[model samples]
Target: MQRRRLLQSAALALCPAACEKKRRSPLPFATLADLTSMIQAEQTTPLLLVEHFLERIAQIDRSGPRVNSILELNPEAKTIATTCKPGLLHGLPVLIKDNIETADAMQTTAGSLALRGHKPKRDAALVTRLREAGAVILGKTNLSEWANIRSPNSTSGWSARGGLTRNPHRLTHSASGSSSGSAAAVAAGLAPAAIGTETNGSIVSPASACGIVGFKPTVGLINGAGIIPITHHQDTAGPLTLTVRDAELLMQVLAENFTATPLPDILIGARLGVLRTQSGKHPQVLALFEATLQKLRDAGTIIVDLVELPNAREAGALAWKALLIELRADLNAYLEQRGGDVRSLAELIAFNEQHRDTEMPHFGQEFFAQAEQLGTPEIIAAGQEARKLAMQLAGPEGIDAALKAHDLDALICPTNDPVGLIDLKSGDTNERVASTPAAVAGYPHLTVPMGFVDGLPVGFSFIGTANDDAHILALGHHFEQLTQARRAPAFSAG
Candidate 1:
């Protein structure tokens, strides 16, 4: 009751006019379309909207539930909201994952204490595009430390600088990562949408767990420059949003080729290969997936069952080897270009060792240490081989092969298991994840809320071949329309 009173008082103080308006929105789960419509109806100003969100962050993130999703807020957010011009996004507030650079007062730490005070001189390429489209850069959200590349036994969403970001659905559960904060913030209504980068399960896993829309565009659809790196081959940023329509709008702004052909009536008679190998273990998740497939069948969709990604397991393993080699080269290059004190992978490992109390409280940098052991010659040769084999096995021989062999338009599977219990001592306990094939193939993967598992949300994934982002997104949008399965989090107790 005291927390509720505090939140009400803060809202009244910070947004008096909006709070007094009889018909004003009370929840923070506004989508891009909802905000644009509110603006069109003269119901809200961008600055007022920004204040509402900031106040919500203060009330919920810092006060009540303490989601801890946001790390550093943009001090200039109000000024940006006041000055932003009308465009695709108008005045939508966007929270970026902390790894993405912004040439502002906020630091890009990638949730690590070692890079705590480091600031990049320029915004990441996607950040620049988003600003150009008239979105206010609200702030940076917490993420899995170093984008979850520091340790093999690291907990997802637990960071030295930002602490642990909790699941909004039910506190004390994992939000999954390395895009944990982005998903959590969007789910909790702290932000309408957020930018999340993924290498493997990062984006889709979190979005699924948080019960929102996560779209990982085909690698190279959006430029990855200026973002902290895990691997250049697989790292790409996309949006985590309340709805698929919002995802499409954000993708249009981010993708280099924005010409998305009008979505054909893809649902009716569309052949979708069910990735039988990766549908996750949780019975509730499986039940929800089965129900979702039934919906597709009722809508005239043809299900291609028993579809398997050839050599998928082997390819996933090879992809990890590729990431280690790429991480050393890619991350060092980024660190050097940013001109930070920790300019190399070796120095970063040393700094973490020196700051053991804070940086290694829960996990050590075994991944970093392994990455540092490789010389450039071995890194390059191994990276080339791993990338080559993984791409072939996951792409043409994996997703593409299944699609062609079954005459399918796309592939579908469970995005991940339900949100796991947060266990810092044992680290993240996700046992069933279905993002590897798309991640390794450099393909577009879209995960939309499918249904719930014991009141916790789960999602279904749509995977398409490279540059088939529009098609998969269309499929997801249609699925979202048919199911309308996403529900706002209940903010359940620990």
Candidate 2:
């Protein structure tokens, strides 16, 4: 309460009239385009915008509802806001997942105590792009410890350094992660948008659970350097935002040579294949999916039903093996080059053991130990082979085959089950998700709000072939305009 008061005072000091109105309005929930227009109209300055968000973060995130999404605030945020020059995202503040690096006061620990004070020598490549595009590095958000790669039984949003990030829509429910905080913060209006990384469901699943838009671009589209590694083959950072256009704007800034070609009529005569096999078993979720299909049909899109990707199981298994192998190789190189006190995967495992009570309170580091064991030259070579085969099965032979056979522009499915109860002992109950095929194939996947089931939000996905991000975005943008499905979180207890 005292913190909230201080933030309120800060807002009033920043801009008396605007702050008073902002306090009573839904400015926190405003879209990027809305904020940009306000900035251009001289209604709000960058400093004032930062102060307003700081107040929101204090009121709900820390005190009132206690969403616990942000891990740390960028101490220099106000200063940067005042000085940042005009660009596409001028004056916008964006929260980043804890796994991504920022050369600032905030630590990029990936929500682990192992690297509690670790700071990168420079910002991650995407962070650099965001700064160049005139965005304020608002803070680092809590994430599943080590991107939910530690244990099979680990909770989705619980992390040693940042604790658990709860769903803003329902406090008791899970904020599906490893991008939990990023999604939740945006949903709760702590920030307009946030950056989340995905090797698989990290971005889209959480966005689905939080009622927002999550876009995972083709893996190589965005630079992966300086981020804490998972697997270079499938890892990429993308935007989690209130709208698909916001995601597209960030993508333009993050991915070089990328341009947003507005296709207001792209949905007309478009062929979208429905991946029924990937849709979950929830009755209401399925019903909502069917309703969404009908809405697309009404919008002149041709829906191809029962279009399933081939060899998904085989591709997933292969990708798992490859990720385990690559985790060791990729992480070792990153930690060594970063010059951290804990410098290798082996040392990181030992650090967890040393801090077992805090770091392993909910689950163990079995995945890290397994990766460490698979570190032979021959095994590494075999893992590379597995990665190659997995890409083939998931990409050319899977998503590509399905699209070609149906002459589809993209594929569609449910992004995830509804937000579940947060169970630390049992871990995440996300048994069914549509993130794998596109994730393994290193293709573009975008999830927008479909509708709600008993007050909990679900997502509709658009999966396209590699480098087909623009078309996929166009489809999502059109759907977003058609349905206007996204609603601001009510911060209710369910």
Candidate 3:
């Protein structure tokens, strides 16, 4: 009660979330891998480069600077960064979401105050891959508290411990979440590239709002051995990057599932499904999508008119239901077996009760309490039906059905409506259509910077079925290779 009361006092300033577009944080227009080259060419050392980023954080993050995406910096970064070796992206700096673990100094809390001091014993599989590939782990960025599982109606990017991350594009605008800080960090040049995982819009939504490239590969493409739990059925890590090439570069180095292969000029004879229903997005976003589509058509790409999936809505509904059930079951397993300093979900609720002073300051623990009681057979049985319904509706029934009908190699849609204004008292307006279907179905989805709206960026997405991942990536790469629409934001005074 004490924690809640104190937190509620400042809730207006950072209530359900902080106000968006706080300031115009224009970014240095650049690519991620290019920074690696500049570092290697003796133009800068990894230490100096990392320091420059740290300086940027000092200037704009939520603390002194108040951009507010980063939770903690790795103290050993400067010491470890000086030792760069041979690899595709040797010495590139990476910012990871707090949910992903690293055997480093920083604590992985998924931005929840519950485990603020808890530390993982070792690196998650992807982190290990990044280290092996010669990339430096910069630090952990914030997320929608607990990857946005705390509540169905929870605000994006509002964590009690980390606060809310603002978008670099327009400060008062929503940066999107659960990968909020990761995307904002990339857009703000706090780090060259960052890893963001998604069950639904966790990765892609933020990447879209931050006006960067976000990629969610086919499930199982990347191993998930040591990350925080969500729906195991659809969760996967991806790149929220500045360019398609940069996103792809990160993927090549990270995915142990593949041996690195040089990509040729991707084929132009691809058939793409233009999701007309997705056109009702913000006019500015639609304008950019049309331009990109016209460019692809002019370049000899086959554009197909694909109708809406008959069961897409049902699939979306089921995906949300399954996530709630899986979150309870998966989080319980992780919290119980992980043997961390933090207690179980039920205990967490009690801790929040005991320390409601800090935990429930901004929002209540309704979801946590619900999860605890949901272990009953009624909830389990209902959850199972939802899961089954989702698989049939989203999978072979919907997207696949459309793909087969159109002979589509990929489907193109606006990543989301332009980033909305960040509001504190109320949570997100939550109006945006995402590529979440692809995410929920465990398919491959890629968002490339298509154009800017209000001087801020939004991306165009390409989604494809599992095993057909290569085709979609190729299509995205081809468009990205041609239309380089991405530009870093300019840090403007509010």
Query: Who wins the lDDT comparison?
Result: 2
Give lDDT per model, in order: 0.88, 0.91, 0.77
* Estimated TM-score for each candidate: 0.95, 0.96, 0.89
| Candidate 3 lDDT tens digits, 1-494 | 45654663575467333312211122244466666666555555565666677777787784443778898888988766777566776777789999998877888888877786677788999998888888888889988888877765667888878888888877777788899999989888788789999888788888888878888888788888788988788888988887777877888877756433345755467788888865565777777788888988888888886556658888888888777777788887888866655557777777778877666566676777777777878888998889888877887887888888888877778888776677766678886756767876788888877788776667788888775655666677778878878776754333
At residue 407, give the lDDT of candidate 1: 88
Which candidate model has the greater lDDT, 1 or 3? 1
Angstrom error of the Cα, residue 4, model 1: value is 33
Task: Name the lDDT of candidate 2.
Answer: 0.91
| CA shift of 209, model 1, Å | 0.4
Off by over 4 Å in 2: 1-26
Show pairs that collide, candidate 2. none
What is the overall TM-score of model 1 with all chains considered together?
0.95
1 or 2, greater by lDDT: 2
What value does the lDDT take at residue 71 in candidate 3? 87
